[model samples]
Target chain A: MSAPKTTRAWILSNPPTDMPDESTFKLVEQDLSELKDGEVLVKTTYLSNDPAQRGWIQKGVIADRMYFPPVEINAPMSSFGIATVIESKAADFPKGTLVNCLTNWREYAVIDTTLGAPYVTRVDPIPGFKETHFLGALGLTGVTAYHGLENVNVTKDDTVVVSGAAGATGSMVVQIAKKIIGCKRVVGIAGTADKCKWVESLGADVCINYRDADFKEQLIKQTEGYVEVYFDNVGGEILDLMLARVKRFGRVSACGSISEYNNSSPPGFKNWFEVIANRITIKGLIVLDAGARWPEMIKEISEAAVSGKIQVGDANETIVPTAFEDVPKTWLKLFEGANTGKLITHIV
Target chain B: MSAPKTTRAWILSNPPTDMPDESTFKLVEQDLSELKDGEVLVKTTYLSNDPAQRGWIQKGVIADRMYFPPVEINAPMSSFGIATVIESKAADFPKGTLVNCLTNWREYAVIDTTLGAPYVTRVDPIPGFKETHFLGALGLTGVTAYHGLENVNVTKDDTVVVSGAAGATGSMVVQIAKKIIGCKRVVGIAGTADKCKWVESLGADVCINYRDADFKEQLIKQTEGYVEVYFDNVGGEILDLMLARVKRFGRVSACGSISEYNNSSPPGFKNWFEVIANRITIKGLIVLDAGARWPEMIKEISEAAVSGKIQVGDANETIVPTAFEDVPKTWLKLFEGANTGKLITHIV
Candidate 1:
């Protein structure tokens, strides 16, 4: 079989503005390179659009120095994607296999899976679920949610408050906490009114819009009792606010700080003293540390999905497959808070 | 037995300046009160002068809350003390039984043991070592160090960094970590050159003075690798400095923040971002939480002491039996940093 001469992809031509705009990324066509020995050629099936992707493209110092090598000018930008192994010389993976491969936002690419950090795994398609679920509920976001809840040892009686509740990880957290642990109350804080409703639909007992004028007061009133476990996804002000309401011996799982990721200046909390007064236990976790237990997590999430106990929104839920050329535009939509659930691109 | 008609005690008539003067505390004589059922009358035997007590009185705050009850204009002040059960109506504790009691700063006190928090049990002469060890190495301070280390899971391969290395809890932590875990290296940060030497003698691989202008730089240099465990006793800037050098998955047992306890406006760290990037875990612990494990900790400290693996500093080793009227004056010495090691008063 002959490979296509050209492939479509999006490149970050400029850094994002206050709110990322379509101009930030430029769609382009590039010549496809032939696969070398020990390499596998793949075609993007589902491109995962996540909030964290916004930070990866920004030009600034991050707390953990978590910036990707600056997105080169006019080059296909990299991201987590579910791709199909069209051809392979690797022993473990065979051609024509549906695999969840984290790669660039391009229609096709050649990868030396043996050397690349983006792990590629064979996907066993589950009935009634779209391949995109692998980009979400069955993927990194789901595992992260599971790890946070498990690491903090969230229980049924725990009053868990999740920030960024409508985001991928946060949404998964709410569903897992409510369905798996049967938490007494699951509160969600999202950026928009619609996001709040979506979080509530995910079994959150209460959902608050952080954009509300009286957000702090309303949050305190809703969570009148002290918070037992705070699953922090969006940090900065929300984290500081939650710190004040944490009960004695409370646990805080620092999963992500999306709020501060794009801030021009470092944000500081004025009431960190609560960490001492209440004897709160705050722990930071990266999903890589949870790799040791990923298989177990995948099994649990798969069972939950099969039993219909965990809802992953909808399967046919599709955003118009933005061309690889439109990766920047699709990313801008995410930053503008226009996309709900997961955003993916179907490579031609 | 006829009790004395007048008992001598010390009362804090007014809050003192930088260092408390003898005149700041008033010595007075008062008539003894009758003991009730379930009550034991005790004479002060070993009055523990701890740095925490200084913070309590000087700032009127302990653990971020008001510590002082109004002085009532002219009555004696109450404080924690180790006393002997001179007269008792309680069955468990009989008259002439040596007990570690919490009492007022008076020659004698009628205490209902049921209403007080127990500090220690009736032991056989507390060995030939100073009975004051019961207040330091074998008592609350020692237990605090034990719980912090155990809860944080400090291991042999871990690099342990402890602040307030010369103070009661700090000194105990350095010794316990060195002797019990066989940690790769134990670094201590103290306030004075002399205290640094004391910490070094306690088996601290490196002891740096926080008073130095290049304190933060020196701390980074000393902890050339990464800090795996940090036992924080002095919180403010020193805690911030250590926080910056903590490696991924580092654990911080926040025992106390002595530096900020006295400051009217406590300074905060700007680099809390490290908590996320490095995946550090910060836990605040009060020794009371480790209630059932007190005996275990005492056994461990005792073994280390008996084995000559750890040495208690000699700066404040002097034990004097003084009338209760001297407590306020003696406590003032702790505030002035004039006394070292563990300062205790024996009841004659």
Candidate 2:
């Protein structure tokens, strides 16, 4: 195949006020014909959307910051994706090889293998599953779901409770906690009835809609007793509510705060004293924290997926792939509850 | 010495709304006749006061509760103290032995050694340290401070910041972090200038008075970079501030909340999002969690104190031993900020 003369890329025009829109991003053409030594060219297949993108675009940077740099204005918007290697000078990557890395939302990526060694991963492509699962149910995203539960030390007897249960990572967690981990009960809190049902189908013992007027009461009644592990994806009042119901020595992992991501002054957590009283451990986990030794996690997830214990996106669905221009709107669909399982844009 | 026929005791009239005052507790005489099998009678020497007492008496018992039971109304208040074994029916404890246990606030205690095995400890007094050091620097109180820093995984490279650094456990934490752990820098957050000096004299590299108007600015300037471990004793705004300054993968130990013990409407924490942003870990620690293995901690603390590297209470001071009736007033001194270092009552 002839090497592409130009790569269509998206750059941040300005930081969004609350959430990103098309205006926040500008499309630009980049020349990628001349490749440097040890550089690999890859065509983007599936662009993964994550809540962490909001943190990347925020105006005020948190102290200490992240392992990867933020998506700077007038620069290629940073993202993670699976891609097909079209050209390579790197020994590990060859023509037509599929790989996963920080693939920008563009047609192709020019990855320098030296700096990208930590993130650039070769995809084995688990049989009987969509390639997007490499970015979803059986990949880095899957490792995040698995590691978050591991942080809390989930047990077979634990009544594991998770918020944002219908979303990508949360849904994966609910399934793994119930099926593979053999937890006593896996309860999920979602935003709507449809979302709750979708979560329940994934083997959750019960799913409570947080939108309900008596949400806290419903949660207590559903779980029967204190929660041993709370895998929280949505922070704010939901986190405080779970803290109230946490058992002694309970563990909580603050994986994401989709609920509070867009708000400046998120609600104050009132039940924090409960953490001290119960000797609970609350930890924050970034997916990137599952570093270097991902082969183990990838293997764990792939085995689960292949053994019929995990679910990925349907390959049989009638698909109208998201257009490059619609990427921002498709990303907004994540925060708006437009997708059920894994939300991704198929560029190929 | 002959066994006492009756012991003077202080009992709770009712659980306090916030801080315990004179009216909240009552003085009475306890009459004892005989000891049963496995029972050990002890003459109270020094009743050690802890901020956890307020938690024990709170109307809303924190979930998971405490290692010891709460002080009941019209009953002897629950507390830990140093006592001399006056009479013993248990083989483990002999007469004249200095034992540490939940002696309550009384002149004499009848301890059941079998059940007390988890808490009641026999201390081989160090040659030059005051007996009160068994409660102050070398007892369970000291274990709290030691283990709280241990939770945060303090390293030689860590810039350790501690809140409530002049209080009993807090002061011990400062000394242990600096002198024993050899952390890069030990910055203490205390309330008064005098307390700050006391903390500094104990080997803190820097001490900031959180009460000062420019406290936050001073903290930022002194810390220079992110704090790797925040050993928190006084939770509230100070805890929030330290959380904001935590490094990526930094840790925090929620040991005590003296500031919020008196307020039902304690100020809400605003910087909790920093926990996620920094991937920080916050864990609550109870000394009892180190059950059946305190000998190691006691040994570590004793060695530190015996080497003149740690301080207990003063042995060369004109000290007015607390009157039995003034016990309630004396305990209140902890919250009033009227006392420095170890706050205890001598029930002679």
Candidate 3:
């Protein structure tokens, strides 16, 4: 098939003061320019929706000082996505070959493979594993879980606690901590009962609902006293509670703060003194910082998936098929906790 | 000399809701017990007053969960002190020998050296070094400084920041980070101009007065932007501010929180998110945790002290000839930032 003459693209119209809504972005149809000698024309197939997207559209110093530059206003918002090359000039990307690249919210676009990393990457589909696994368990989400636990040097004797355990990275952490690392106990925290059950199904010893009135008591009773390591995905009050529950010389991997991303002033940590009293160690993580080690992480995660030690099936993912007009609305579901597991958008 | 038939002691009358005051303790004369086998009768010569003593008397869970048991009500308050043995039944501690041990506020007391560690340890005075050095730079205060920096893995390339730079542990940290570790830049924070000067005299590159209206600006300007390591002695707002100034992957040695010890509700950490955003690593330190490594640390610090590489003289100490009736009042000075360097009470 020949490349389309026109494409529909969504651009960041305005940065969000809080959570983004439909008005945060504007959609427009633009005439496609010809591909360069080393570029390939591709059609967007699958788009990955992440909580980190909120950080990209945030205003002021937080957005400016991020690991990667903020998505420029009036420019197409970008994230990891799968695309099928429809026309190509690069020998590495032939026609009809599927690839995972930094894709914008556009129906059709051109990728310059010559630019190398942080732009285009070739992903080979493995037999019996769905292509969507590349965007979930074997993708950045999986690597984030793998490396964050490794960074804190989690041991098999550790009693681990994982927050946001139903979410993408948290789900992977729960499985890896229990099934792979064989931690003595793995307790998960999620927003709803269904999500808690789902997390428990993913190899967690127990999953507590943070909304439960007795959440704190349940956490204490379930962990049998204190936690050895805390893999935190949701920050704010939950983090404070965990700080109080962690054992002396415990470790905390501050991976994400999804609970506070949209808040202008997140709740402060009152239990911070516990850090001094208990001699705890806390380290923050940005998965992109481990770009060089991605190959090793992916290899281990892939082997686990093939051996069925780690579940990377539909139960571990939430893929919503979206019409060209509903992309923004579908992405907003992430903030509302409307989906479980890794949320992916199938462009129909 | 003969052992006294009666001894005067100060015991905790009640736990203070805020900072401890003169009313917190009651002085009483108690009849002395005979020294048993493996025991020695000693006279208190010097008392080391520390900010951590406040934590030892704090009420509720904080006090209950401390590394050691809290100073019980109506019990003599305990701290590190230097004593000279007068009468001995123990083979190791002969008459007229000086030693460092955990001692209560008493003019005379009996110690069973058989209990060993945390109770009594022999200290050999080095030539040309004041016995007070064992309470300041050569004591727990100095080991705290050496091990705290070591626990965070501070390197020569580090631009280090030390809060409470004029206090005992802080002063030692300033000297070690600058003269021993040879950090690229060492900035200190103190409450007064004279204390700032004292810290600067101890090899700090620059010492900023936290009382300065432009303290934050001066810190940023003096450090040339960001800090690589922060050894926090005073927590609360200063910790929050330093959290903002630390560079990506920066390390924080959470040594002490003197500023918040008296407050029923300490100020929460508002910039806690910076921990995740900057990928910072914060580890709380309790020097007792490094007991196994103290001999090595002391050996190195002693070598440095003898070589004039580290300052362990009167210039780094504040020895107050405190009267028997004024022990409680002198210790309150730590909260006021009234004393510079190590505050030692010379019991005449």
Candidate 4:
């Protein structure tokens, strides 16, 4: 197949001070250059819009010492997604190969396989699963939940509480904690009643809508005021509340702080003393660090899916597909809580 | 020896919201009751005042699910101190036994050894050491520092930062981390220049006064912006600041939060997201939980002291002696940073 002459891409124009808007990115047409040795020209299939993107685009203090370096000004925004290699100089990733990698917000991207522009891994499409499943249940999202729970040594004796339970990573955490880990109870926290119901359907014993007037009271009642493990995705009032709600010797997996990503100045924790009083242990995690263990995570998740222990329904049900031009809008939807699970942009 | 018919004690009159004051406690004379089986009448010699008492006096949400139950209204304020058993019905604590136990702010206390009013352990007074040594270097304060540092596995490779570095536990931490653990570097944080100098005198490589306008910058410069382990004695802005200052995969031992102890609504951490970004691990500790390991800690500390590896100077230098009737005022001094080291009420 002949390489495409031009590619349309979205570049970060102005960094967002608070919530990102249309002005945060600029869509442009870029001319493609010939691929170098050990580089592959990949046709982007899907673009992932994750809450983590908000942190990556930040500048100054917020961007300092971050896990991933901030996206440079006027650089193509990056996402973890699916792509098809059409032309390649690299032996590992040849033509007609389906791979998952850190893809740019462009239709065609040249991936340096040898130098490793982030990373490139060839993924075998599961027979019954959609391609987007590799970005959700069987990918980094799944690995994050799996490794964090493992890090904390969550067991069947634990009553697990997961924040952002309706989102992709959180939904997987809910299922994995309940079905695979066999935790005594799995309680989820979501933003809306519908999201709560969806989280409950995904094997959470109960899901509390955090927007309720008596949300904390409800959490106290459901978990009996003693959560053994808390998988925190939202950092703000919820994180503080969980600190107070957890029992003595509680373990916290600090996954993501989606709630505070948009805020320039995030609020501090008021119930932090509970950490000392209860002898709690809070650990932060980054899924990218678990690259070596991805195969293991994928194997277990695939087996569970095959056995109907996890992903009982359509794995693609949670993926909200958006047009490529509307990628920035779809990314903004994450903060607005518009998309239920995973939000993906399908290139036309 | 016959027990006294009456005893003077300080009781919690009202819980303070921001800071404990003169009116927060009441001194009263109580009629002593006859000793029962397994009970010993103890004459309080020295009362150890701690920042933890501020948390113990809190009511409502702040006191909820605390490791130690809150001091009840009108109940005697408790502390760890030295006492001499004058009269006893307990075989374990015969008359004239010098012991260390949870003592009230009073001249005399009746201890039920078998029932274990908190706990009572016979502390053999070292021939060359002052009796107050048992309350500082050889007591819970030292144990807190030793165990917390050990809990985080602070090794020679670690560059440790300790908050409240001039206070009892903090001073011990500075000495132990540097002289015993032999860490690469030990940085201390205190409120004033004199306290910082005192902290540095205790084997800390450098001590920064947190009150300085460029305190954070000073900490960054001193530690090269990468602290491997943080022994957090003060929680609030400093805790949040250290979260950002620590290296990736850094370990934090949450020993105490003297900064937030008196605040009814303690401030939240603005830099809390650093936990997720850096993959930090924060573990809370309670010295009371390390009872079984006390012998191990005490032996190591004793050996270190004798070898001049820890407590090289006069062990009693940090003990700020006050009159028994002024116990509450002595405790208030802890928040004001009035006392240089350990504040103890010397009963006349």
lDDT of 3 by residue, A131-168 (tens): 78888798889989988998899989998899999999
lDDT for each residue of candidate 3 in B1-348, tens digit (9 for 90 to 100): 556988899998888757778989999998888889998888899999998888777765455246667888888888788999999999999998887887689888888899875468777879989877887788788889999999999999999999999999999999999988999989999999999998999899999999999988898797666889999999888998888788888899999988888886666565666787789999998888878878788888899999999888887878888998999988888888888899989897
Candidate 4 scores an fnat of 0.77
**Model 4 CA deviation exceeding 4 Å by range:** A61-64, A115-118, A312-323, B61-64, B91-94, B115-118, B312-324
Ranking by TM-score: 4, 3, 2, 1
The local lDDT score (0 to 100) that residue A84 gets in candidate 4 is 93
Task: Tell me the tens digit of each residue's lDDT in model 1 across B240-304.
Answer: 77777888788999887766544544554544555765688999787777788888888877877
**Candidate ordering by lDDT (highest first):** 3, 4, 2, 1
DockQ of every candidate: 0.23, 0.39, 0.48, 0.66
Span of 10 residues, lowest total lDDT, candidate 4 chain B: B312-321
List candidate 2 segments past 4 Å from native: A1-46, A82-128, A151-158, A221-227, A315-326, A345-348, B1-46, B62-64, B72-76, B81-131, B151-157, B225-227, B265-274, B315-329, B346-348
Candidate 2: interface RMSD equals 2.3
Model 2's lDDT to the true fold?
A: 0.79
Q: Which ten residues in a row have the lowest lDDT in candidate 3 chain B?
A: B59-68
Q: Between the candidate structures 2 and 4, which one is better when assessed by TM-score?
A: 4
Q: List, residue by residue over A182-287, the lDDT tens digit for candidate 1.
A: 9999999988998888788889998999889999998989778678999998777888789877788899998877666555444455445557556789998766
RMSD of 3: 3.1
Q: How far is each candidate from the true structure, as Cα RMSD in Å?
A: 5.8, 4.5, 3.1, 2.4
Q: Clash pairs of candidate 2?
A: none
Task: Assess the local accuracy of residue A202 in candidate 4 as a C-alpha lDDT between 0 and 100.
Answer: 83
Fnat of each candidate: 0.35, 0.56, 0.61, 0.77
Q: Give residue B238's lDDT in candidate 3 (0 to 100).
A: 93
